[model samples]
Target: MGPPILSAVDLDKSYHSGSAELVVLRECSFALANNERVAIVGQSGVGKSTLLHLLAGLDRADSGEIRFGDRDVHAMGEIDLARFRNRHIGMVFQFYHLLPEFSARENVMMPLLIAGEATGAPARADELLAEVGLEERGHHFPSELSGGERQRVAIARALARGPEVVLADEPTGNLDHENGLRVMEVFERVHARHQTAMVLVTHNQELVSGFDRVLRMGPGGQLEQTDQEAPR
Candidate 1:
């Protein structure tokens, strides 16, 4: 395998609860290979979401090094980081954060518009919606779509910029079993189609089955590969 597309080294983060320091991450390190799918599973409050946020540059580590290829993520200034994230990193949250007034295609076209690539934004959004099996729903608003369909739209929006890596925090956590399964199928198809590397943080062990690597985050912010079997 070649060098990782994204990586973190000796990461540390802490929050102050009154006078007490809540250490969320300590010496945490990770790496994501090109086009690889990695699942991070752990008990609640184990910093899984924290790690994802740090990787996506949504949050800062008290001290650490985050790298996307040769570029240091944390080292970038605000404007540069924002631009980098807009063009290179895609983020998906458990709750679909679609704009209430925008249609599905409009939501998918958001990143493209923000990046000043609006020349063909509509066509690109349509293509992505089609990829996620939502071609016919492009005219609908978030309120009109079901939970699963909303999530699929979020997924389509995430892939809008053709990002090198997607950091997803519990992408399937908000859905029922059937909808969750549908979302997972969409992920499988999207990964296969775009070859986008993904770091998925999920509490559901069953969701990790198709990933290339499964990592368990300990309460101390340590990450280790797990040999635990996923239910068939």
Candidate 2:
């Protein structure tokens, strides 16, 4: 692999509580190469989400550096960071987070709309819905879709801006086994089709098996490699 598309070094984040400080991450470090699909698994409350936030530049670390390609994400100004994130990173959450008032097509078009590409939003959104097997359901509202379908919309929304990376946090947590499997399949297929790097924070080992690598977060915010290759 060439230089990492994403890299973090000596990351540290903490919170103040009364007179004490609660440390979330301590010198956390990792790297993700282009087109790599990686899983970070650990028990709840191990700062898995925090790590994801810091990596995505959704949150900042008290100390350390987060680099995307060669640029320092932490060092960028707010506007530039927002633009960079929109253009380079996409995020999917366990909760679908769609607009209840919008149709599936409209919901998927949000990123493009925010990016001021209104003219092409409809076409791109329709294409993504079809790619995720939701073409016929484009007119449906969030309330009209199943948990899996909603997540599919969320995934399509994440890809709306044609981001280089997709960061998913417990994406299948709300689905049943069958639907969860289907969602994972969607993620795999989308990543393959787009050649986008993915950083997935999940507790499900089955989902982790399909990834290129798995890293487990140990106590004290240390990361250990679990797998070097995807399972057959």
Candidate 3:
């Protein structure tokens, strides 16, 4: 095994509700290995999404440190952090946050465009769309696509930058059984092919099968390792 690609230590976070302080994570910490698929599963309000957000640098922690390789994520300045996040960490949310104005191909091209590449984005976008099984839907806008198709577009967009870590929170929560299965198949296929470290947290227990590891988060943000079998 190699050194962790992403790691958090003594992660602490909380929110204030009037006079009460709701502690979400109490010094939770973990290290994700290279190309590892980790599922953090728990019911709602148990800090699953909070953990993912912290991992992605979308939210700051109350206390602790996060390391993406040797870079200090928590301590970096906003501009540098934003660049690092854009280049290294890919995030997928429950609601496919596709730009309604942009077509599936354009949406997938976003990361490359943001990096100041005016040319070659479209071709890369098309390749990603096809990889996610969205080649036929590439010209469609988010509003014109099915829920699963939208999610596939989102997945394709996330992979556009070839991120080292892909953090997905409730990625399949909005899909039906069939659509959810489709999304997972595409996600697994892409993950296996790219060797990207994927951390997906979901409340749905049925989707836990193909992950390399399952981490069950309790009601209080406690974590325990459960299984490590992954399909080949």
- On lDDT, the candidate that comes out on top is 1
List model 3 lDDT by residue over 31-74, tens digit each: 89989888998778999999998989988999998999888898
Lowest lDDT block of 10, candidate 1:
223-232
The worst-scoring run of ten residues by lDDT in candidate 2 lies at 223-232
Model 3 Cα shift for residue 83 (angstroms) = 0.7
Off by over 4 Å in 2: 227-232
Predicted model with the maximum TM-score: 1
**TM-score attained by model 1:** 0.97
Over 1-232, each residue of candidate 1 has an lDDT whose tens digit, in order, gives 5799999999999989889999989999999999999899888998998899889888899999999999999999999999999999988899989998999999999999999999999999999999889999999999999999999999999999999998888989999999999899999898888999999988887876988888999976899989864423
What RMSD, rounded to one decimal, does every model reach? 1.6, 1.3, 1.4
**Residue 137 displacement in candidate 1 (angstroms):** 0.9
lDDT of 3 at 207: 82
At residue 104, what lDDT does model 2 achieve?
A: 99
For lDDT, candidate 2 versus 3, the one ahead is 2
Clashes of 1: 0
Using alpha carbons, what is the TM-score of model 3? 0.96
